[model samples]
Target: MRYGTLDWVPALDRPDLLAAPVTEALASWAQAAPDAVRQVLVAEIDPDQADTADMTATYDLPLEASANCVLVAGKRTGEERIAAAVVRATTRADVNSAVKKLLDVRKASFLPMDRAVADSQMEYGGITPIGLPAGYRVLLDTRTSAGPAIIGSGIRGSKILLPGEVLAELPGAEIVAGLATEIAA
Candidate 1:
């Protein structure tokens, strides 16, 4: 759907949900990577019900929204590392192909909701790349560098705004091509 300026919704003015899991994650990320964290601007949204449409409308930005996928690997040796990948709303993270190869794990998959919630200490819908375990390998899609993007805040009702470049600062972030593709509207 083509949205006009009139269809745009205003950005939320404050990051008021301090107690939210996503907010907590953001705070943790801020302490770990102050420079990277500074680039993000947090906003509140309905984490449980929010999706690309709600995000696009609420942010009053173009439909070209940026998001990061949190991929966790479960190794045969019983180790897990959270990985972050940036992609546009129109594309899906190439987890099986790109992520699996990058992590050098025999198997890589999306973190189960319960595990993700526990690991990130954020609600299922609100997981973001920041504040994850220091060992976590964050991978950013080169496309994200094109502009500012929004990512989940480790809670369902909030998002963090920042330039895509900040993603590079994560411990093991790698920039790859064709990590995502546009989804039909």
Candidate 2:
């Protein structure tokens, strides 16, 4: 699966995608993370083609290597818990059963797109877990966290590639078994 030359530049140098906070967090995490997880890559992308299917076909990225991060919110006891779930593009997150239980909530639902964008301060199609607002739980499906993966760069015009372990090890990241289920063909 030759992903081709995405012009893998240091994440720190790509402020266009890796916002200041994200960059800062990555820098700090790298200091303590394993060598394989230290190097984060960012590549220029066309905003219109940033979606998983489009990016994979146009950029030569393997479908299996692409991971999607979805924001979910659950409420219980009059409190809201918002989390980001990272799953392979080939599957859908098991939000109702798995995530609801993990969140200790009666139900879980996708976060509203407008609120997600505004709260995360990231473009709708480019919300990565690396720079999410402080205290938001990050949940990585075991399949996604088991290897390297491609994800959004927090902006529409760029993409990021990093070891899945990095995502699984992000602050408050929880590797959930069966967090995602394979989508029917």
Q: Summing lDDT over every window of 10 consecutive residues in candidate 1, give the lowest-scoring window.
A: 1-10
**Per model, how many backbone clashes are there?**
6, 0
Candidate 2 structure quality by residue, lDDT tens digits, 42-70: 88888999999999898877889899999
TM-score of each prediction: 0.73, 0.92
Q: What C-alpha lDDT values do all the predictions have?
A: 0.63, 0.83
* Predicted structure 1: lDDT: 0.63
Q: How many clashing pairs does model 2 include? A: 0
Where is model 1 more than 4 Å wrong at Cα? 1-37, 74-81
Tens digit of lDDT per residue, candidate 1, span 137-174?
77777787666666766656766666777655644567
Model 2 alpha-carbon miss at residue 168, Å: 2.2
